[model samples]
Target: MSGGVDSAVAAARAVEAGHEVVGVHLALSRAGGTLRTGSRGCCTIEDAMDARRVADRLGIPFYVWDFSERFRDDVIEDFVSEYRAGRTPNPCMRCNERIKFAALLERALELGFDAVCTGHYAILRDGENGLELHRSSEEAKDQSYVLGVLTADQLAHCLFPLGETPSKALVRAEAEARGLAVASKPDSYDICFIPDGDTRGWLAEKVGTAPGEIVDRSGAVVGSHDGAHAFTVGQRKGLRLGVPAPDGKPRFVLEVRPVSNTVVVGPREALAIAELAGARFTWAGTAPDAPHEEFACDVQVRAHADPVPAVAVVRDGELVIRPDEPLHGVAPGQTAVVYAGTRVLGQCTIDRTVSAVPAAV
Candidate 1:
């Protein structure tokens, strides 16, 4: 059950619902697996132990499968390359799709399980046709944005027992009621590979930083930045400019020029973007069949940001998100999850923003 309160509670809920359940935790990285030998969080070895303990408490079978090589190539490598290409990537989404559900689900099937269950704060409801993935009732902790990458088959064999329950606080309360040890464990956020949350420092070690010129849209040099990878689409602080702006306002990161290794600084308004395009189109349903249909929907390009109304259109082999309102700092390599109310429509990887698009959608 991953040794987390949410997953533990999920396993409990499965039993409460009269389903025979077993726990499985993936050792996604051989290296991270070694770390889990000691304690929880990320790839550490202790988390594996904690998972096994939860399984023992539930009187269910549990096992840790090695998925290191696959995780490195699929999640870690993709995370690095996205930044090298000057785009903000969501590694968690990559992990959920490539590692957790896809890899673990396949492994679970090999072990003779009917379906897989996890701590994800989302749901699946079986209709006359098939199962439909829906956002969790606990919207504050909703994580369907990352899980949107799952295909229809994956969703069918997945059970998200925490879907309709209050999260965090209520999950902890359940854990206490069950007398589980991980009830008070802090929630895990940030990229698991970069456990310390130092993306720039980690990138420097892996990608090698080269100091570059910081400039503005006019092609005039404004300042110097540590490296292009060290900046993102809308970062404002830590520019360390020597001169003040003409209007005496703070400067913000507008663009990252990977070709010249330059970071462009400008007013915050310069970050507004109204269009987004990307590849690797994946939809639980409602895509491919109706590829040309236009639907007004909420498009969320990140995990926690609020979705904005947008018209989705596919053209020239990529998904185009034409937002009805301006979206600030829309970056490539991030996922744009479209939603129709609580139901997820589909998802696409952001390639870049278009010019002269409507101010909103």
Candidate 2:
């Protein structure tokens, strides 16, 4: 259990299902707590203690595994590097794919456990032949986006106990009835390592002071920013630009050119995107065997963001996605997840926006 309400209820469900369950909190960190003390993050010792308490209340065994070093090297460091490369990174997905399900699951299976169970809001079913990944009854809290990277073999070896319950209400009732301490804890949605959701501050801390320029589409120097690391694609407010468009309207950030230390600010219409090129795609429920089959799906470029209709063509290992309805503000280094209804088909890391939407939209 991750020392949270959902996981607590998940544990209760497992116990009700008559399955022996053990709760383990992963100890992963780098600079310090993954989030502020009260915020949602696994790095805090308090979260570990919370997981232990859940184990105690549930009458199950609990242990804390120290994987801090590995987490830093694999997740945090990679997050920093991806931002530096002008790409947004999904550290949570990385943690799930690397530490939790990959490393910890393997260790658990090696220790003779039948499977490693999690509180993820996705269904696992006994299909015609084996376990299948399905949409959770709880659509709002469906975390199938991050878990989409798992392989079929991995799904066969895993268990998700809270798949059928809608998260915000049903999960709460389950936890409250059980009298668990974390029954009402609010869910965390920001980056774990960056408290206050300030990724620019974290990048500044790691990359030192690298100055950059802010210019318009015509390459006119409009403003000078502190550092290119402090900006991202589609950003607007902090551009510190004193310039206005011909219509006397405010401008927004259009690009972050790290190589030349430039932050481009322009009209909001410049942010629309129609196509995107991504690499390192991993499909979950099913893998599209060919390019024609792959591109025939809708995709999401960010979490909690709407999934626009799209098609994918997997060239070699890279999947290039073209959205049917123009998607605005497509950013590099962000994840583009594809889905069909509630089922997660696959996802890829964004490389660049090739076809963008019309500015008016």
Candidate 3:
């Protein structure tokens, strides 16, 4: 349980189903005093206590597993390194891939658990091929994009009770009916470790600031930044450009070149991405029969972003995707989840992007 309404209700349903259920709250951070400010963050001391209360009400075992060290090494460090490499990573994806499903699920199976159930809004159906991951019944609460990293083996041992639920309101009502204390708890948002929601400030402390040039597409120096790591693709504010654009239009961050220590800025149109590819990729259940052949699919770059019609192919040991419509604000290190309708095909950590617009002279 996450000390949230969804998980509490999920636990309740699991218990009602007559299965022995254990609620395990992961202590992802070693900080004991970590507290949720409104709904800004999660996995804190208060969240654990709330989870325990829910477990107590359900009359099931509850344990707070300390996964802080592993989380720091995997998710936190990976976030820092990706930022240093000038790529915008989704830490939630990493946590789900490495910590939640990998580390937690591994330990759960060893302890004789049949499955690791959670409150994630995603569906798992027994398809013709095998078990397949799909989007939730409620489109608004769908989270299959983040769970795309789960392999066939992992998906087999997972259960998501809230996947078929019509709405979050129902989950909250169910929790309240069950007398769970977290029924009215607000949902957590943003990165859990960075409770304050100041990502730039948090990254600055980890990646020390360095003077770097901000250049336009034509190789003209437009501004300077404290650190190239602080900026991301499509960011429009805080450039502090000494020289304004010739057309006086606002310039956006087009790229962050860590090797050159340069922040590339240009017009908003330059943010359109024609192509993106990554070497590191995984299938949700089973690999496509023709892995090297081009396939029609929809590519979702961000968690809440709309999926775009695309053609994907595996060539030269990389998953190359070309969206029919150009994608804006796409950056390396961001995960691109491929979907065929509601079914999650797989995902890849974007290693590179090709701009749709030509460079300005």
TM-score of each: 0.93, 0.92, 0.99
lDDT, model 2, position 331:
78
Model 1, CA-based lDDT: 0.80
The residue-by-residue lDDT of candidate 3 on 55-100, one tens digit each, is 9999999999999999999999999999999999999999999999
- The residue-by-residue lDDT of candidate 1 on 89-157, one tens digit each, is 888888888888888888878878888888899988875556778889888999889889988888878
TM accuracy, model 3 = 0.99
Candidate rank order under lDDT:
3, 1, 2
Order of the predicted models by TM-score, top scorer first = 3, 1, 2
Best candidate (score: TM-score): 3
lDDT of 3 at 199: 94
Candidate 2 off by > 4 Å:
30-36, 126-131, 292-295, 357-361
Tens-digit per-residue lDDT, 1-361, candidate 2 = 7777777887888888899888888777644434444564444666777778888998998888888888888898998888777666788888888888888888888998887888888887665544456668866777777787787777877888878776568778778888888877777657766656767777889976676778887888887877887777777676677666667777777677778878877776777777787777776745655655555777887666777787788775578887877787777878888876666777777887863534332
Q: Against the unseen true structure, what C-alpha lDDT does each candidate score? A: 0.80, 0.75, 0.93
